[model samples]
Target: MKKAALYLLLITLFSKILGFTREIVLSHMYGASNISDAYIVSTTVPTFIFSFLGVAIATSYIPIYSTIENEKGIQSANIFTNTLVHFVILICTLLIIVAFVFTTPIVKLFASGFDKKTLSLAVLFTKISIFSIYFIGLIYVFNSYLQIKGKFVIPACIGFLFNFVIITSIILSDFFNILMLPIGYVLSYILQFLFLLPFLRKHKYKYKYSFIIDKDTSYYMKRIFYLSLPGIFGASVNEINSIVDRTIASRISVGGISALNYAINLNSFIQGLFVLTITTVMYPIISKMVVESDVDGVKKSLNKAINSITLLVIPITIGSMIFSEPLINFLFGRGAFDSKALSMTSEALFFYSIGMIGFSLRELLSRVFYAFQDTKTPMINAAIAIFMNIVLSIILSRYLEIGGLALATSISAIFCTLLLFINLRNKIGSFEIRNIIISFVKVLCASLLMGMISRFFYYALLNNINDNLCLVLSVCIGAITYLVIIYFMRIKEINIIVNVIKKKLFSSFNVL
Candidate 1:
């Protein structure tokens, strides 16, 4: 599991870097302006719409496939896959028509702050980008299929192609018409879908073209639909929170939407790099364990995953908070991203960092509940969180502006994560929550100390060396400080990692 996680981590890291570059390119070309804001809202509308169905289906599809494959065999799973593919295409096709017809109103819904000119631009972009959902839906199905087949490489690589295409499209827009932006966005997903086809064949997946919802298909399809309801509600509630944030942001200022988007992309970077890699690797194993009725194994896996998330994400959260400005400035200070944009983005990033651990754990815990095929728990918890977020965002944004919106999200996530942990313990008859809390405290202490030292080091050298160089060195120093502190603290998770590194080093010496 560690080996698989590591492999996917490297691939995910590369892909996330490219994804970040895509954002950087957009910021460089468009910055926190009406153009970037319109493009973001345009792209977000389709993704938000598709996610209501696509995410719920894709997430629910996994354990369902596991169940079928275990009972009926590989061919049965393939049939289900084919049926789902056709179903998604049909649904997404309908969605595209509705969204296209109502593009202006939908864009208006997301960004009520936009004026006539900006609204027109956003509608145009949404019209083009909305079609990408067809490809996006298929990618979700195929990616889930590939992951079930234990082919993580190709799915992980899709980000590479997807982000590369997006980056290219942004650059092309600079030279050509800005309309190339949405056009290229759609093209990326088409290429991603095409890229996944042959690999599906290589994995022995025979794509039979059948849209007939026959008896067996109907039964299982209905089951998927039933199982997906809670998930869809959960996802929809979360999307509502997002729409609320964006809507409020739109009202806040000119580039409020773009600033939130940029900050979110940064937050997503940390989640993708560690939390996602661990969860993606563990989800299948946990699902299989549940299928085999290995309750002990599931408990161990949950404990380990939770511990890993704390050990990794806590320091990142602290470091991000400490150096938010320098980090944002270093990454996005140039091009059209001026001082005001940097200040807005940096403030948002700092506030968002507060909930990093909450966000990471909530995602992992939610998936665990899904493995148990109990999506209702997460759904209820999400409803609570989203309600809190909506209320907090409204009240907080009045004072904190963009920062308040992000802070509200962080607080809500943390609250939701707490609910998940408690309910999971109740359902599973208790894992190692006490131990996890103890370790979390230790990791928090180490990370806090490291942050202080890193902050001091950064300021000490800020006047002596180049600002970016100083920031990079300070991050390196903080990492070293964190490792040293954790090693001395004898944190169990860090010890496991340390032992593995030692053994690898000893093996290399023997090889020499």
Candidate 2:
């Protein structure tokens, strides 16, 4: 588990850095403009379709696949994957065709407040972008298979290909104009999907094309279908919140959607760093444990994950709050991105940052539900959260604009996190509630102190140093201070992190 988590984290870290570069390129090229808003709106539905359905299929398929592979054989598992992959393709392709045929109305629904010309550009972008659904769905299956096969590196690496392609496309768009944006969007998905093929081949995963669903395959489909629907609904509801946020932001101002997108992207970068890495490793392990009825093992993994994730997420959240403006200015304050854009992005980002711990906890807790084949609970909780999000977004966007949209998101997440925890304790036993709370308090206090120090240094260096330099040094001090506090407190989770780094370093030396 440690090895898988580390490998995924390293690969994810690499991709996220490039992803930052991708966002920086976009901010420089477009800033918070109508073009940016249109692009964000255009891609929202397609990405939602995949994230909604594709993640449901991919996540729900894994435990069952593990069972088949273990009980039936590798041959059976391969056939199951092949069948599911093709079926996902068919469903996604049909949906995309439908989406394509209704592109104008979809764009209208996505951002009803757009002017006629902006709406037309958005429709065009949506038409071009919707085709990515097939690729996104197909790749999700392939990527899940890779992870199941203990091939985390390739799956994570392919995201870099997607981001790099987008970055290149953004660069080219400077010369060519807006057409390159949607084209590059589609092409990135295609290239990333293609890149997965070589790894599929290397793994000797045979593609036995069987359109007919035999009784056994029928059983697999029924099981996966029953299992995936709630997940799909839950995921779709969550994505709808994004669509809702974007649509509301569209009504707020020209750059509201763009600002929201920037905030989301920043949060995603933070999430991909550790929240995603740990859960990527945790879900499969816990699912297997659930299948075997290893109650103690499931409990152990959940406890450790919550603790370790907190050890990192809390500090990062505090650091993000302290450095929000500087980070935004450093990454995006250039070219088309002006002072107003920077301020909007930073303010929205601060609210997003406040939800950092909530986001991580939500993911880890939800995965436990999925592992136990209880997707309905999370789905139901997500529904409740989304309802609040919609109500709060409408009320708050009236007053606070983009920041209110973001704050509503954060508030919903916190509610979801708390509700999931309460439900999870009733479902399974107490996940050491007292201990978890104690650790969180310690971490929170330490983070607050570190943030103070970081803020002081940031202001102290603001006039004496370059913007980026001040930001970098302040962040370094904040991180080092966090480390020192954790060490002095003798947090056991620190040992887990240190041990992983040592092993990685030694492994590199041995390879050398």
Candidate 3:
């Protein structure tokens, strides 16, 4: 289990690095312009669709498929796969049509502050990007299948390829002087779908049209819908919160949307690398344990996940907070992204970084409930968080501009995390509360030390060279310092990561 998590984490980390590089390219090419804002708003539509449908499929189907795989074996699981693929394809197609037809209204709904030209651009981007929905849905199903089959490497690398395609498209747009942004996203999804075809073929899992839902299939589907309903609600909360931020930011200035988007992108990159990787690796394992009624095993896995997440994320969050300005300037200082944009984005990133641990915890703990097939608790909590976010965002945006939006999100995430943890303890009877507390203390202390080291190095580098090189140097020094401190602390979990790399290296050498 540790090995699997480590492998997935390394691949996820690589993908995130590529994703960040993609962001850097986007910053240079588009900066914090109205076009970038339109691109951001346009991308949100498919993403919102994905969060609503794709998340439901992933959360509901993984445990259901795992259960079938465990009890009835491979053939039964394949049936489930075929049924789900057909269902998702139909649903995604319908959604694409709805999105296309309502593109203008939907864009206006999300970006209410946009004027006529910006609204038209957002609508155009959304219309173009909606074509990727079915392909995106197909990729999700295939990726989940690969994950359940223990083929983590390919699934992890697939997202990196998607980012690569987007980066290429952005470059092409610059050369042609045409808005090829949405085209890049569409092509990426197509490529992602195509890339998984061979794997599906190897597994002999061909997509078939099956409108005939049997009693048993319908039963499972209904169960899935019940389980996934909360996720949909939760996703709605997120979308609403995003719309609130974008709307408020849109009122601020032309680049307001872009600033918020850049900061949020950075936040997503971190969460995807650490939080998503941990949750993905753990969810199936947790589900299997739940199926077997291994309560102790569940507790043990939960503890390890919590410890592992805190050990990695605390330092990164603190370091990012301490060196936020340089990091932002280093990565996005060039092109139309000016010093003012960097400052605004850096401020948002600092506050957002404070919520990293909260978001990471939320991801892992929410899955714990999902593994137990209890999604309603998370849904209820998400509703509360969403309400808090909207109320606070409206009240705060009046004073703090875009930074207020980011701050509101951070506050809401922390609130959600606390609520989830408390409710999880009640549901599970008891957790490793003592260990969690102690481990968090250790990680926090270590993070503080690392933050100081990062700050010192950041200032020193800034004094020497206020350019991209200094930004790069500061990140390196901060990372090295954090690792060294953690090493001296003898965090045993770190060895798990090291061993996985060693195994991969040996496997590669043997192939050579």
What are the lDDT figures for the candidates, one per model? 0.90, 0.86, 0.82
TM-score per prediction, in order, is: 0.98, 0.95, 0.93
Roughly what TM-score does model 1 have, to 2 decimal places?
0.98
Per-residue error (Å), model 3, residue 416: 0.5
Give the winner by TM-score: 1 or 2: 1
Best by lDDT: 1
Ranking by TM-score: 1, 2, 3
- lDDT string, candidate 1, 150-209, tens digits: 878789999988999999999999998999999999999999999988887763655555
| CA lDDT, candidate 3, residue 36 | 87
Better of 2 and 3 by lDDT: 2
lDDT of 2 by residue, 1-512 (tens): 98788788888998999998888888888999999888888778798767877878887888888888878998888888877977898899889888988888888888888998889899988888898998999888988888787777888988888998898888898898888898999999999988988878863665445576555677888888888888886656557777888888888888878888887988988888898899988888888898888988998888888888999889889887878888888888898998888888898998888888888899889888888878899899999989999999999888888888888988998999999999999998877888788888989999999999999999999999898998999999999998999878867778767787899899999999
- Candidate 2, residue 110: Cα displacement in angstroms equals 1.6
